[model samples]
Target: MPMIRLPSVLLLLTLGCAPAASPPTAASPPTAAPVQAPSAAADGLDAEQQAWVDSTLASLTLRQKAGQVVFGWTGGEYVAADSPEMDRLLEMVERDGIGGLVISMGLPHSYAAKLNALQRRAPVPLLVTTDMENGPGMRLAGGYALPSLLPLGGGTSFPPVMALGAIGSDSLAYQVGRVIGREARAVGVHLTFGPVLDVNSNPLNPIINVRSFGENAGEVARLASAMSRGIRSAGLLSAGKHFPGHGDTEADTHIGFAAIRADRARLDSVELVPFRAAVRAGMDGMMVAHISMTGLEGPEAAPASLSPAITRDLLRRDLGFGGLVFTDAMNMGAVIRRYGQREPLLLAMEAGADVLLQPIDPREAVDAVVAAVQAGRVTPERLDGSVRRILAAKARAGLHRRRTTELDSVEAVVGARPHGELAQAVAERSITLVRDEAGQVPLAPGRRVLSITYAQPSDIMAGRAFDRELAAGGWTVASARVDDRTPADEYARLRALADSADVVVASAYVMPREHSGTVGARGGFPALVQSLATAGRPVVAVSFGSPYLVEAFPAVPAYLLAWGGAEVSQRAAARALAGEAAIGGRLPVSLPPRHPLGTGLTRPVRTAPGHP
Candidate 1:
């Protein structure tokens, strides 16, 4: 395999963006000032108050003041629920006086409990935040999965709201946001750090998948604005993240430092549209990414997270966001490389970020920020500005007071009767069966069914729930996942089965990185679809990773978009296999004309008889 390399000019452009040189004037460092205790104002917050912010900052001790500006932890990911790390985390706030806490994937429920507990121990409130992009379920098991934006980005008619632009409805976006809201509020989370506004014009891009709204900048802007509607509708903070842009870059932030090299003009034309639209749509925060955009910032400086240009001039001054600004992850490679093992919380705060997403050491970081404020390196006004935004979101999420969900009945809620019914309804509605050139739907009972598959048996969990769906469904189901040694022969095994079975259903979940990759699946998938079709099986190609599989194997007479390879998708696949309804959904994104988008056939959603 060839090594992936970015273009030279692009690399140069990314490395060069820096804050223009300001002529240096000699100034002496300020000495210590008496650290006063911060107090909440007697007057209550207005319908939209900045006054509380004023008093909160004024009352904080220098150390507490710094702690208020620097967020603790990189994300929602927790270190063993209420572990020593948790105690240390509380100490950073209650004792050392840090600003906020970001709960990551592993520790959401723990975050909620600890934060609610800390409401007693700490003088100030903790701005608990999470990247509940797909809702808390994306972190914990059994949460309602809002369709990740990818599959929704592909189709016809609705055609991914990005395709619609002004033709798109903010109401529709709000409806989606409402879904996000409903899920977020149920989980006791105050903020959802997402609605990625990156423009994914490049199909081969690695990081962005359905997470992006669309390819067209205008469309992406419109759809992203819709997500803002979704965020607010849920009464949670919706953050426009990975600023200035992450989609244009190909590297994954989980592993390495990535960079975007676009010029100011280029950024405005392509990347800035959705971000501006999101701000206009009332998004509450901006999460700066670790990815470097070279010339866009000060020379020899780090990512926009710590760049004065990207945060202050562009976000606050020019765009007038006035909202909270955040860094993607203080623990990521980009920040880690510069900081080494030590925490650099003060730099992030001074760079204009109101909240730090995740950090390696909250105690040290909070102390550094405290020392910065005491030393007058960071201003009180700037610190308060960030705190106010966080408080507003907390108020909206009803986090300050006790808001309880029946956790005892949490089991009943997950895949609950009502939710499952809703899922089945949406499933039938979303089924987009494209390319039935030979009319594979509505198969008769006697037609033998051959199922060929691909999976990790990992992302889906240690045990498989899919087998249960296949076993009880009254169809002879067979599956094989692609791996280094077995994939080639598995194709033959599938073909032999396809030859015997009256209809052949082939599913693919090749890899995690497929959604925006140049080539999808392994090298052999197209061949597998081809060979199966050659066997004269009515090769029904089901895309579990993406709905765009038709582009790769248009020769297969039958194709179905399962969206993702989750339990919901599996159930939908079985229903589609049984021809439960027509594939009514049109393709949301474009593909080869041969495959055509918006290809599913399904019955219209039925209204409840008694309710009607």
Candidate 2:
């Protein structure tokens, strides 16, 4: 793995401005070393790398320099190297000298081949990146799909950094990060838009639900820093994202502008804590969100991604973040709906963003920036600074030496069994027993268990795995699937089936989706589940997605927070219910007066009523 080499002058500038490093806490794992503050000689650029950066910047025209900061996107699926789309994209790369490409989705080898082809024809080495929030499997098929971070925080069958917080293991967080980094690099990804630092302070936040580590700033900061350290240790750049904070907002920026009304003091104590920790952890990049901070940027503030007050004055000046600043997808409705396509590109640059990600039209965006530089609206020096950062990042990734990923190694390295086992171990460790007032859990094996799953109609029945795991334990399990649109009559039939069961296990899987406003159970599904809990039979409510599902169904007698809808999480829930595994995870976020943060009930595994 190649390392990023910083110029001594740049290091000095950052060192002079950066905040003092925070000392590691007593609870911090031994691996949680205090991040060293920047020094002039620390990772200083090698003579050769510096010479290359100088030569590359000196040779590029203003148009080419502008292109160097614009990143293009590839579809989530495979596009043949010879396809028209590929041809058009390649032409832009060659003609316009685009600096980077973000792969939205693809198979491993096919994606690697496309990336190699693009690198071959590019004027400058491209910094290839992707949103590997759930690991490379988030975008690449056939890779291990780690459970979402929310479940990991609450307790999932998959290992998530949030689980590290629950387990209070900084070393485990580092391990998860290292595994993610290794698997990502194996699949040809250079940088991951991950370890989402959002605090998820608002339960109504449309998009950032379980993706966050937890709601507490200190836990989020500690775990996120550990993951970022692991990523850098694996030789991959980590981008701590949605700067200032997007955790407290109600709207999804992908659809429209989301605003955080926090004043500076509240922002410093809550939202900014993780970002400050990220900087101390030596994070490589900071992705600015499309959110508006009305407190800092005024009531009519520009989107944070396009506001100099938020991006430059706040993140750069106030926080002293010297990393590459990337704007979240410029084509998102939040920015495009308000500003013209070309204007946001220039505005983000003027706001001190080093990368303009996912622009609507790469060529036009490049042209707009070039025109601004030429007309003196954006200065040449400003353009050079961004270009320098891009070039330095590419060099650090070893793109300057070897731009192509090894296609043959993808299958052997990605989704390996050891990695999957690690994910499972984490998930099992994070399973939280929220409430068991009637002692209905560790259910006897002979009980007739009715498993009702709530999910979107189009989504895979996420609860089937739970049923299978329960059946394997010698329990009589009947299963039914219900979505938001399921008719009342269908729920009535499910209730009738529940009457025949000794116990009812209601599994709720509600995750965030674009344009969706809430992460709670939709429609009459909550009512149906509540009816089962209130029925004569004992009901064990299992949350497979949101940890806060209890708020909607307070009547549930026994509740277990499994934290995610993944297969591992489902299996863990089943195992916990069958006395096959202990419930050890604590909540990473506060559920208010009912179940506060760090609340979890531990249980020892006992023989089932009918088993030895």
What local lDDT score does residue 151 receive in model 2, on the 0 to 100 scale? 21
Provide C-alpha RMSD values for all models, in order.
12.8, 8.7
TM-scores for candidates 1 onward, in order = 0.75, 0.89
Alpha carbon lDDT at 14, candidate 1: 6
Clash count for each candidate, listed in order shown: 53, 8
Question: Please, what are the lDDT tens digits per residue for candidate 2 over residues 1-612?
Answer: 001122222110000001022212112122221221112221345676778888999999888999999998875345676889888888779987889988764556666778888888998888888776645555555222223212211111243345555666676677677766666666566888878998988877878877788899998898888877777676678888889889999988877878999999999999999999888766778899999999876889899999998888999999887778899988888898999788999999999999999888999989999899989989999989889988877766666667777776665556555556666666677788888999887887688998888887544537767899999988988988888888889988988888888988888887766666677887777887777777656889888777778887788888888777667777888888888877788888787668888899988776554653
lDDT of 1 by residue, 72-104 (tens): 653233345467866776677678666566654
Candidate 2 accuracy as lDDT: 0.75
The 10-residue segment of model 2 with minimum total lDDT is 10-19
The segments of candidate 1 whose C-alpha lies over 4 angstroms from its true place after superposition are 1-51, 74-85, 105-114, 143-173, 294-302, 338-347, 373-377, 395-424, 442-445, 461-474, 484-491, 510-520, 523-527, 534-536, 547-555, 592-612
After superposing candidate 2, which stretches have Cα over 4 Å from the reference? 1-44, 142-161, 607-612
lDDT of each: 0.55, 0.75
